[model samples]
Target: MAGNQEPLSPRARLAVTAGRAAAAVSRAAGRGSGSVIGGKVALRLDPDLLAQLANHLDVVLVSATNGKTTTTRLIAEALRANGGVVSNALGANMPAGITSALAGGSDARYGVIEVDEKYLDTVARDVTPKAIALLNLSRDQLDRAAETRMLAERWREALSGTKAVVIANADDPLVVWAASSAPNVVWVAAGQEWKDDAWSCPACGGVMQRPGDDWFCGECGFRRPVPSWALSGDEVLDPHGSAWPIKLQLPGRANKANATTSAAVAAAFGVPPQTALERMHSVTAVAGRYDVVGYRGREVRLLLAKNPAGWLETFSLIDAPPAPVILSVNARSADGTDTSWLWDVDYSRLAGHPICVIGDRKLDLAVRLEVAGVDFQVCESAAEAVTACPPGRIEAIANYTAFQDLRRVVGN
Candidate 1:
């Protein structure tokens, strides 16, 4: 609802108005996915709402285990160089949010969509985006139903003949394998910080071994594909080895990779490196991610780590030990029903650090921290924990639902 550049006809405007009305009613009733429900209502009335709305719009669909929201945000921001971009920054990847996002904008020239991993194939088949950026893949932890390898296979099969160009992280073998399925792909040498899930060759089911930075499968001779764009150190390097300095408002190498990923996709869409870098560096946060908030006279920098892989990636960004950290967990519907993934994370990395455990699954985290010999105290909420921390920028990490809960608590 933030950007709308085109004017709609009387009938189309009425449909969008009806959808907005539904969204207002849903929000007034305190319902989740108001945008989704609103979009659904609009779709019910006009079955081809998204197709008609985004008929001439250049669409970029993004999917991965993590970094979908932030990556989508970066791409959208960069694409603004051309014209308005209709995007869903609400962590919504399904029909409802995608519909609202595509239909809400009347004049935007592009749509940057962050799709849910499970729904990627379905969404791609329907929308036929201009570019599909695959960040990386790992176990989502709570959903034991779908496997990562199978998802890649499905992606390959689904995109076999699609017109969209695929921009993928070559460091992630699963991503490479999946993106390779598409007829056209622009491989990116974006490093994969986490490689545990991709130990097996997605092509031949052979064992994959890393010899230095390159991966090769022994049994089937499958190997890494050459990348057109590569992230080396703090620079995004092209195939000719020309480097573009990556200056981001976000922290961590993971984020640098994300910015580079966005740059690569945007460049493929014809945005200049200088312009793309400027737009991407302007983003300090995406939704609630990496937001620094003031609550009860303490500064709490919020971070989200939903699974073991996410925790492993996030820990690299937090200040080292003894700095007093707040760790919150939850097992609600959005946070996954299983809290067992806590055991999978290497909280031992913060072995000597002081951590204030909070949330519905704080006890579970406490037990895991205790087993790792971490110093911790239980608090009623993340707000309380941050308030009790030392007088400095306090680091607070949480799962999906708990992250949202912490924001509400801190806001009040």
Candidate 2:
């Protein structure tokens, strides 16, 4: 067990063993990582297995529409400086997978959990985390995950009177509203690139006014809180007016924002900003995300972008024009059924690039690209897409399942 914590009940112990066995079986059967299935089996046998496994460790729950996995990984690495830390580094973020991760890391001193947006409250209530990182929330899986405001309201209701220290994104109005009720909060000015979902105030349901980077609700007094930590250009400014350059192996401003929030969360756990940032710099990729692999004799960089906000951030991370871009999308269960959010992305930015579209939802993407006045060719597979482009370095952006498919094809 972790530290000097009490031992789990015999039933919980049995549940953990069963979960691990099930996970092994799943892996042997050529299934996925089996974290979720293992978790489900454990929960079925002992519904309170998660609480038992998490009781001994200092837990940090990270939730966001984007960067949850990367931020969780970064926080875990930073916390490792203090002692042993465990996390769902594979991005299996639901309750089942989270439970599996905790059960597997029962001996670790710290638990850094990447939680699904919808399951944050449920997981937090069970785990009783020491710190919670609320990154920016945007429109994601609208058909399944509900609207952003509703999710924020749930977070607000769940976080009210909580004992955990909330490290929230101050620049994101939705995140501000969600973490405002928490007793202790460390606010970070993590920039929000996709403002399409946050136009209305979550507090007053009034139109939000944004002049420059600041935002306030005119109808209500709710506004962007003064952040203790702010990201200015390429550097992150701490509360004491000291600036630290964010030189992470990860790319884009979204990742920089995630790193900033991770540093704050780590600081809450008694780690210094310098140490946390230094540990985070070694993380080159999250799961298969941001991995550059060879395909059809070309170096292809893989980027995952599920929703509009994710797509917007991914676009900034890709190589510039003349490098060619491969856009892939899928309407799998993991990726919400409705592909309407495709229209929300600004694909016009890739106008100059030799764009190739592939995946289950490539036709829908092609239609959207046509409306955006961007030229694109439909492809059957990632291999086909890569071969079509000129041999050199190329960028491949994909949604959930499509990214997995591309990884399989690229053998990453």
Candidate 3:
């Protein structure tokens, strides 16, 4: 439809039409956005629909354990400086949802895709992206997704000798190893705050040696690559040794790292660093993340953290003590059914803060908090949690489904 270069077969056209109809029905029924279900119906009718829809547009796939949606949003915004860009702005990173997004943006010249960590290879094989951004990989949805090393190995295999420019995070050992096999790579020192999953080398399975910010494997010769783009404090240094300040409206160092990666990917698409950063700065919130809403006469900021690495980054983003904190968790199918990852998060960080816990898995979180010697109140809902806190700005951090639940409750 949008890329009319090579016409779709009659069956493919029918599949697209059917998918749109299903999506509209779903929306009318108030089930959900209908992207995933629509894409599923389309793909079931035409299994090759994704490749067909992606044929004419330049595609860029962003994949990681965390930050996929935000980075994809930033990249899409930056690429808009060049031309029309279509993306799954919702947190859907699987093939079905991706197909729905591409089909919907038929007039877009570029497609920026946010791919789930495990689905990266599958999406890449289909879309034949112009560039791939490999951000840091850590343990996430372990019950459903493969281990970090296994995922990295798959990525390395998928990217071997790829024609697409691979923009990778050099600071992430697993990411470096995965992109090592790619023929074209642009390394960026985006920084990794959580290193629990990357302590061993993906190449040799040997203990990794980290001396300051650099990492290497003594058992094997694997090591961190010298990045062409590096983030230092609040500025990003381009390959030309030019430093550009990362002035994004997004909060936390994690977002700064994401912004840096976004700038590099934008550069690959011919957008100047300054222009891309300028465009990115306009993005205040991403898919309800960092959205501050008034609730119970208190400002509640929504933050999503799905795994250990994500929780680590989220801890840094929360407002300090007096602001109060609400932590919510759920182990629904969308979120991994395994709640064991709770043990890995350092809930002790909220030691001095007024803490409130809610969600389906509040008991699990409460136990973890109790073990950490943190004071917290178990609440049945976000409203109760907010009511327990003093009237002021409140930070609400939640896991996948819990975050969505909180968003609905807050009407954001």
The CA root-mean-square deviation of candidate 2, after full C-alpha superposition on the true structure, stands at 1.3
lDDT for position 67 in model 3: 92
Q: Put down candidate 1 lDDT per residue, 274-391, tens digits, no spaces.
A: 7898889889988878998888777788899997778998999977766668899988887788887787788888766667999998888899988887778999866578767877
When summed lDDT is taken over every stretch of 10 residues in candidate 2, the lowest stretch is: 1-10
Using Cα atoms with residue i matched to residue i, what is each candidate's TM-score against the true structure? 0.94, 0.98, 0.98
Which sections of candidate 1 miss by over 4 Å? 1-15
In the predicted model 3, the residue pairs found to clash are: 2-106
**Per-residue lDDT of 1-412 in model 2, one digit per residue for the tens?**
2464578899998998999999999999989888999999999999998888888999999999998999999999999989898898898999999989888776689999999999999999999999999998888886788788889999999999999999999989999999999999999998988898899989889999999999999998799899999888888899999998887999888888888898889888789989999999899988989898887789989899999999998888766688899999999999998999998899998989999999998999999999999989999988889999998999999999999989999965
- Residue 51, candidate 1: Cα error in Å is 2.1
| Cα distance off (Å), candidate 2, residue 42 | 0.4
Better of 1 and 2 by TM-score: 2
Q: Which runs in model 2 stand beyond 4 Å of their true positions?
A: none
Off by over 4 Å in 3: 1-4
